[model samples]
Target chain A: MFTISLVGPPNSGKTTLFNKLSGQKIKTVNYPGATVDYFSADFDKKYEINAHLIDTPGIISLIPTSIDEIITIEGIYSHPEFGTPDLIITTIDASQLSRHLILVNDLIEANFNVVVIITMNDILARKNFSIDENKLSEELNLPVFKIDLTKDNGIDELIHFIKTEVENNFEKRVINKISEDTFTLVNKYNRISEIEKKVLFPTKTNSKNITKDFNNLHKPDEISLKIDSVLLNGTWGLLIFFLAMSVTFASVFWLASPIMDLIDSAFALSSESILGIWGNNWFTQLLANGLIAGFGSVAVFIPQILILFLILGILEDTGYLARGAMLVDKPLSKIGLNGRSFAPMVSGFACAVPAIMAARTIPNKRERLLTIFILPLLSCSARIPVYLLLIGFLVPTTGSLTAGIILASIYLLSIISSLVAAGIINKLKNKVITEQDHSSFILELPTYKIPRLNNVFFNAYLSTKSYITGAGPIIMIFSVILWALTFFPAGIDNSIYNENDSFEQELIENSYASNIGKFLEPAVSPLGVDWRVGVAIITSFAAREVFVSSMALMFQVNISDEDSIQKSLLKNMQKAKKSDGTKVFTTSSIIGLIVFFIIAMQCVSTLAITKKETGSWRIPILQFFIYTFSAYFLAVISVNLINFFGIA
Target chain B: MKVRNASQLLNGEQSEILGIDYNHPSARRIIEVGFTPGEEIKVIGKSLFDDPIAFSIRGTVIAIRKSEASSIIIR
Candidate 1:
């Protein structure tokens, strides 16, 4: 099948053009590598034959620097699996024609069947400049089509031209025949200047100044400048960034609750109805208690993820994301990260999967790696439930202020730990923060434009879809396996229970899941953790939030009563005693458990995403070991030291 | 006009890039994004530390660090 690759420089709107051509709803983020990798779709009778339209990483030059750029280059030239693409659709920013044309010249020289689509003509036209299309085509010897995505100008012409001309002449132009001298960065750019000289002409010579005046052309600059005075003012910029992030964080909690509650009740209602019909047999037990509950627990977080994406989408679309980057770059650079790391690090507070994906915006290898390495330590919402359940035992407080302080402290702890980890790695293993890909820290702050609401909704929808699609099956498989492990050995007959709490509690104890927990009891017993904590730890590997629910189930807390669950779980854990009759969650033990949760690499989805993002198990493996060992030793030492000193 | 460091250029001042310190780390990407010699740029704004001073180059507003900007000689 013929593949047409859409290649362009950053900020060229390549993804928008790709979505327009492919009739797909893919989102376009402002930063480079926001898509992370190529997005391809088959022709849906939008053309004559079956062809793949691929949207690659928006790269500046052919010489690849970062991972995303390398992937794009590989897709075109070096991939062992996918052969070279047939036609190249180069998207050029019309206002920045001189710079954009350099990439066009490079592609043309490399002998790719090139069709240039000019975007942002409105911006150019607003500036009293316009390109003569036929003149440009004659100069470049390739068809140049100008598109206005909002209005659909030149799109139909683009399709018809590509269909006819490409079919006739492109099959044989596979080899790059242009000499090194002909395609040097200097030569291509020099030729691009010549083309600009020939084709680009000023329109409507200003009535005031008959010359081409760039300053007067950009009327929007006044408003933008005025806005930036407050928005990008150092102190105000920081304040606004904090406010923006706080709003995003607050919206995740406030706006999504109704939908989340609706989903929870829906799942509960379905499970109850399914159980009502299926009776109390094993099949009913598996469907009602296991599958429905398992999937529903995960499906509830969808709203929060969607809300985060919606806010982030608007921020990026409004071009405020770049300003946020600029605001944080200096501080983050001091800590061995760039401005790009700021967004992903903030996103880590949401979830690591998407945050790791977001880290691709960082062009520096070590900086990107450091961002990913530190991301998991950020106290995500998944850790919220774990913190709530554990902090109740750690400190004797249900007060609002104390709870808020504790929660904020955990987040603070996460940031400090990750920064320390970055420092350690810098000092010991890799000297990362000192050397950089670019000597100058240059980040483009796009002009403030009204964010297109459709794009925001589309981005949110796409982010939620991807998370569900990527993380769902693994969660399901783990849930099912967890169910089977806790259900098998085929009998409540093994442990005798007099009442409801004991019945559910012993049901897990006599099953295979508890046996696995018992297997790790020796390793954990030193930290004052019982077999139940062991089982909760094992179950939470699916996701950290599952630790709370799994604890609720293992302790047989009344799941039906949401209002009383937190109090009951704390009460049950407080009453829990070891085989030797010593209390399980003594003050020090609870602190140790809290420390472990704060540090341990317990989430499977986090590991999966880390492996995918770093493109190797090696980094994730090191990450896993470093985190788990630190968690283990720290927990053990805290427990032992407190006991030795008779402090708690 | 005599050449001066990009960090030394004041707000709203327009200048052309002369060159950058060849040995600096960010020199390559600086040039890659049209920061080469003869490129016209304006010092639009500056952050508190003058670390990330904003510049308008070829109609795009970009922020670069003053430490690295010092290497970017402009006149």
Candidate 2:
């Protein structure tokens, strides 16, 4: 099969042309290596070409400084599994012709079957400039096609040309590896300048101001500079960045909640109706509570994931994300992270799974790993319910102000902890192994363009789909395991239930999960929580948000309405007592539980994603054990310290 | 004609590139992005902390750290 790969410099409209050609709904993120989408699609019959098109990450020169560039270079010159691509489609931005042509020169030197597709000709034309296509083609000794990607001008001619080339089945071109030393690069740049002088012409000229006009012509667009003046200003830029982030995050929560609640209720209703019909057999239990529940766990995250990517897509498309990264780069660098780490870390506040996936954009492997390692420590929205419930118990009658302050403090603490952890881990890793790949911050602030809505939606949909397919199965399997742990050792007799003990409570008390909790009572007792809270902790390992529902079940709170689940759970928790007649959910114990939830790596979905992104189980396994134990130890210490202070 | 590292150019100041500090780690990429000798570059903007400065080169805006910009000698 003839494979044609699309290669180009960053912000050269390569992916846009690829999308137009293949009619595929792949997203185009601007940052190199940020997106792992290497889409290969068959040509449409309308094009009359039996060829496969591979869209690689946007890259500059063949001498790769980053992973994305390396991938692009590899895809064209030497793919491991598929050898060299038969034809390389190098997209050059006509607006930045001279610099972009350097890549074309490198490809020509390497003797690849190169087809130059000049994109952004319309942008160039708008600047009162035009490229002489025939002269460019003659100089490059290749078929050069200039097409306006925005308006789809000259596309049919390019398509027909490609079709003819493919049909001819031209002789294989042998790779001639060129020396990429500094001298060669200089020569290539010099050569590109000569070609530019020959083929580029002024569309509208004034002889009187030719020199000034020529100098100013190469400056960046007026609108982008104007917007950047306000947006990249030291104070206004950071302020707008925070405001934009808050809006995105607030939308992720608020916009996704309605859909999430609908999904939650839908799953709950399905389980209840199934129980009503099946009359409570083990099969029904597995179907409704285990299988269905697992599916719901996976489905529940779709809204947040979609909403996050959608906003990110818009931000990325508008070219503001690059500026946002530049704004945060200095602060993040103090902790051994760079600008690229900002997006993923902020996304971690929504959920760690997608946040880890977003870490793919950081070109440096060590920095990427550090970002992923500390991401789960961020106070994600999933822990909000647990925090709220615990905060209520800790200070039952306090006004909303104090509770809000406590919640904010918890968030602040999580952020501080992540930063400190990153600093320490980075130091440790550097000491253990010297890294040669120095992280560099060379980012393009692409000209701002109004985001195309279809493109933004497609990006969101593709990313959400990938997350479901990538981490969905592991979440489902683990959800079933958790279900089985709580569901098994079944048929604890109805007769075993006392007057005060509900059948649900009796069943839970006799389940394997409860047994594990009983076994861990000695370990948890120091933290002032009993076997029941221990069971809640174990059940919530599937997801931190499960703590509230698991606690309701353990306490037999009989929450008939969703609105009052918290109120009833709190009331039951406040009254619940141990065998020694001491009350559970005391102030110190609740604080400990809150701290535990804040720090513990309890979400199986996060673990699954960490495993997927890192392509290894060793890191996830180590992350799980290290985080959970530290959370426990910290909880114990907090509880003891609080008690010693007479806070109880 | 006086020459200084590109990092020394004040914001909104324009200069023609003299050459790159070849020993710097990121020199190759900087040169590849049209920071070669004789190219015109303008310091368009500076970040909040003024470390990673944004420059307009080849009709596109790019941001690089002061450390990397220091390698690009210009006047």
Candidate 3:
């Protein structure tokens, strides 16, 4: 099949154009030899064009500064897998033609079949300026499609152009010698300036024109300047940034909770119905606890992920994210990260996998690594259930102001820990990689526009889909394996059970997981938790949310509904005794558990993604051991200190 | 005209870029984004600490940290 690629600078509407052209939700995969996502899709048959289309990462020049740029430039000249593209459509922002043309000139000079598509025409028209497309096409000597995908205008002409002209008439051009010397860039800009002088004109000839003749076409966008005046004001801007972040986080936590509860109940109901019908057999147990519960853990996170991305999408579309980055850049740079790390860290609050992927935006490899390394300590939503469980044992009133304060403090602790960890890692990694230091922070503040709701929703849906597909199967498989670990070696005699002992409890006590937990009891004893909590901690290494299910199995809380399940678990936890006949869950022990969950690198999926993004197992392996050891050491110290203070 | 680092220009000040400091690592990147010699740039906004100053260049607003922006010599 024929292949075509869409290349452009960032904020050039290239991805939107690709979506409009392909008219489908596309799949994203890691580009060869890089973790940056590359979007590729086949053109819809309704267009009658059967070519493969690639939406490449945005870049300013052929000279690579970031991993994303390296992939885009390499993909254009020679992709090891897809080979070279038959045609490259370089999309340029009409208003920023001088800067955007640098890429087009490079592509044309390299002897590729380059076609120019001018975007942001409406923005130019608003500024009372317009490009003479015919003159531009003549000057560039390539096909120019001046379609406005936003209003669905000129698309038919573009489709017809591709259908009739691009079918087989394009010559097979060889890649020429590519040079990124200073003179070549200067010459390209000079040529672009000459062309701009000939083609640019005031939109209305009779009115007071902003342009001084045609030679100088540089007019700063007044609208953007006006908006930035208020939004980027030094004092007011920081306040607004924090307010916006708080609202987004609050909505994600509050708005998604009710829907999440509904999903939780739905999953629990199905699992219970299957068990009730199938009558307590091993098959029913596996289907309910192993399959349904595993699937439920993945499904329940959809609402929070969707809401977070939706708000982030709106902020991104309005061009506020860049400004937000600027607001936070100074403080972030103090910790060895730049403004770009802000967005990814905020995303980490929802899920670390997407957040790790988001770190591709950071151009500096060390900063990106530092950002990824601290992400797990940021209290991802998966830790919410575990925190709630332990907090319930600590706070008598579940919904009291004290409980809220405690919950918020735990989140605050996670945030503070991540920042501290980032600072430490940054200092350490800098020494090792000082020879190849490329720590630079350059950001573009795109003009603000009304957010397109369709695009925002589409992106939210896409991210939610990716999270499910990425983490779903692993959770399911691990839940089944965990089920087997806690279920088997069922040869215990009925006489071993006391009058109060439940059958499920006896089975779990006799299982291999219990043996392992008992084996690990000595190691965790200083944290003031028992062997049951030890088993739960070990089982949760697959994913943090598994701690809740493991806790339920360990306590033998067989309730189906959500509230009753928690209440029963709390009741069991409160009454449970240690091997010395003392209370197992004192205030000190709960504090220890909370601290451990906050710092431990428990999720296998996160480690897998870290390896994928960093392109090595060394960091992930180091991250796991370091975080785990520190978590345990800190937990032991915190438990002892709290005990010494006589809090419980 | 006297030359100074672009980072020294206050908000609302406009200047013509003289050349990039070749010793700086991000000199090429600043030049690639239309901050070449003779290009007119205006400081449009500044963040809290005035570290990452935003400038309007070629009709586009770009923000660069002061450490990197200092590489662009402007008059």
Over the true interface residues, superposed, what is the Cα RMSD of model 2? 1.0
Model 1 residue runs over 4 Å out of place are A24-36, A43-50, A78-82, A177-187, A206-220, A272-276, A391-401, A429-440, A490-502, A516-519, A522-529, A558-567, A578-591, A635-648, B1-3, B20-25
How well does model 2 score by local distance difference test? 0.80
Tell me which of candidates 1 and 2 scores higher on TM-score. Answer: 2
True contacts kept of each: 0.43, 0.80, 0.75
All candidates: DockQ: 0.49, 0.82, 0.76
Cα deviation at A33, candidate 3, in Å, is 3.8
TM-score of chain A of each: 0.86, 0.91, 0.94
* TM-score for each model: 0.88, 0.92, 0.95
Model 1: clashing residue pairs? Answer: A438-B26, A439-B25, A439-B26, A440-B26
Residue A229 in model 2: lDDT: 85
Chain A TM-score, prediction 2: 0.91
lDDT of 2 at A188: 78
Which prediction has the highest DockQ against the true structure? 2
lDDT of 1 by residue, A8-102 (tens): 98778887787777744333322232332456676546565456677776776676656666666666663333367778899998887777787
Ranking by TM-score: 3, 2, 1
Model 1 lDDT, residue A397, Cα: 69
lDDT digits (tens) for residues A176-283 of candidate 3 = 867867755666787787797687788777866444533245757688899898888898989998999978887888888889879988998899899778756577
Per-candidate clashes come to 4, 1, 0
Error of 2 at A479 (Å): 1.4
